[model samples]
Target: MAEAARGLGWHPFPGPAAVNSVRYQNRAACAYHGFCDRGGCHLDAKNSTAVSTIPRAQETGRLQVVTEAHVRRVEVDGEGRATGVSYLKGGEEYFQPADVVLLASYTYENVRLMLLSKSPAYPDGLSNNGGQVGRHYMTHATGAGVLALFPHRLNRWYGLPAQGVAIDDWAADNFDHSDLDFIGGGNLWVYSDRRPIAAARMPTFGRAPRWGSAWKAFVADNADRWTNCYIQKSTLPYEDNYLDLHPTVTDPLGDPVCRITADFKDNERRIATFVQDRMVEWFRAAGAVEIIRQGLGTMGPSTHAYGGTRMGDDPETNVVDRWGFSHEAPNLGILGASVMGTSGSHNPTLTAQALGWRTAAHLVENWSSIAG
Candidate 1:
């Protein structure tokens, strides 16, 4: 890992190790733009769209990426065909005509833009006449695992959030849930020491006195003693949980922000509970003196969030076709995790990238069929 960083002309943090896994908490540690970890990667070392596909797409002069281009709506012709996009580029309003208008933005953002783009052809919103634009928003149900103390120092502070080993014995189809009450399961992981700023946020278990001597002692004794266990549970889509336009709030460019409303169902709770118990067992086997298993918290904006514009064979049930093409607006293509029908146990990045490449390929092959 150090050699890889050095090859990229990025210096690793001091006291680097060959391998380490830190807790990521399923946060947007790296979002679409850059590394969103404890602090933004100043040198942009994290592999994100800004460093990867966006550049390749730019290399082709045919592909134009308008940064700070907030698309307000998808313009459609009289026959209900997508012709172009109306957007704000550098505080100036402009309309760019395209043979096809692809929605390659993030999941929630895609739905939000669709809802805000109301037209006579799409009275409710663009490509949303079925009211299914924001219908199936979902994120995995994951809880943190806590480790008390071990005999030796693992020195876990100097590794990427996902560089360590993961135990996927219980993830997705790997486990038999026949006798269990839930339909899904999670992957258990034991990561390296939690960072200082992140570690301070822990409960302290009421063991550390808040004031002087005891607090200092607690901090000194347990700073590097903790480990992180995370469970990446499967999330099923439901009718009630979804994303929609937030009428109350809008971005700087006058576009509505996406609002999420969802709660963990019984199935998710069961999976979370089962994984927490297993994590405790693993920590015990790893010689943890004490463990603080995290309880399931309220669902919110998840990095692995998916399923606002689903892909399927049926037009009534799904927005995009299997190839991620809009059924109503033939020329428009929707990319990213939003088209996924099921949330795989792993992170969505690799899958999204795979799908992106696949979608781009399909476009290249069937260019006339889709673009016409």
Candidate 2:
């Protein structure tokens, strides 16, 4: 597949992954269990914070992990500065005070928490006096997909999602876009991720019935003969695509849930269409007998959600400053993709972690000024 991509003038290489390839830091290496895609790694080989950073922080005796706590709002003082947070635990409400507050509860929840924490000093919401808390929102354009069928088995029963070849030549301004209708591109990935249940549910390509002997026969023969390519395109935030409190729906706690008003614009659709064509060509070059292309669907909730508390230099257009601190509430910091202003073609995890470390370092270096 890498050779095929290189033949098309695209840069292809092994996709970067966070899973441990060998034993490190007393953690076991990847066992190739193949269930890492949807299930937890029993060997603790995946580099999740729960198994990595949290354990290290706990050893310092300064970090506390409170399980089953539902944070409701951020408490503020008369001067519109964050004081702490109020949460519900064991059917009792409690307030935890702090000198500095950091909100890192993912994108949607971060926006929702800020919106729900309205105070007398800031009547709209926390850090929302300028109404920019949820202005710019985006999710990766990841719906467009291409499935290919090969004549022989791929033997892909044992591998992880990251064990694949990726072509980034079409990703995010890497190639010429002067004559193109869109500004961003997509990253094409073909990985070894096959589960028995999911493989049995493969599309028959109009070769068999929906269910019965013919379908069972088709599944038995073609379950290991097909594969899909993942195409993640760059998405942009727009004025109309924002998040807000749902007027009608509420959670079990009676608090309003987040309401998303978003959709893929023309630029995203154009990129998906263009990239899928390239993907089909690549699959054909790799000896695919039949290929199925999916359409550019409407944008929905995504794991790669970004930008509800956008970071920027201007307070009027952004919620946080360049350092990820709130422009209105100086001591309040955000530590997730919610502060990201743009969604690139790649996953936001590494960038988010890097930004988080940067924020933490800045806070430690300027603790006196920020915590005050």
* TM-scores of the candidates in the order shown: 0.85, 0.97
Candidate 1 residue-wise lDDT, 160-232, digit = tens: 5555455666777776778899887776655543566766554555578776888878767776766676577
In order, the Cα lDDT scores of the candidates are 0.72, 0.91
Q: Tell how far residue 164 is off in model 1, in angstroms.
A: 2.1
Indicate which candidate wins on TM-score: 2
lDDT of 2 by residue, 1-372 (tens): 888888877788999989999999989999887767878889999988999999999999999988899999999999998999999999999999989999999999999999999999789889999999888899886578999999999899987877789988889999899889998999999987688888888999778898999999999999999999889898889999999999999999999999998988999999999989989999998889999998776676767999999999988999999999999998999999999999989999999999999999999999999999
Indicate the TM-score of model 1: 0.85
Indicate the residue-level lDDT of 86 in model 1.
Answer: 88
Provide backbone clash counts, one per model.
Answer: 2, 0
Cα error, residue 293 of model 1, in Å, equals: 1.7
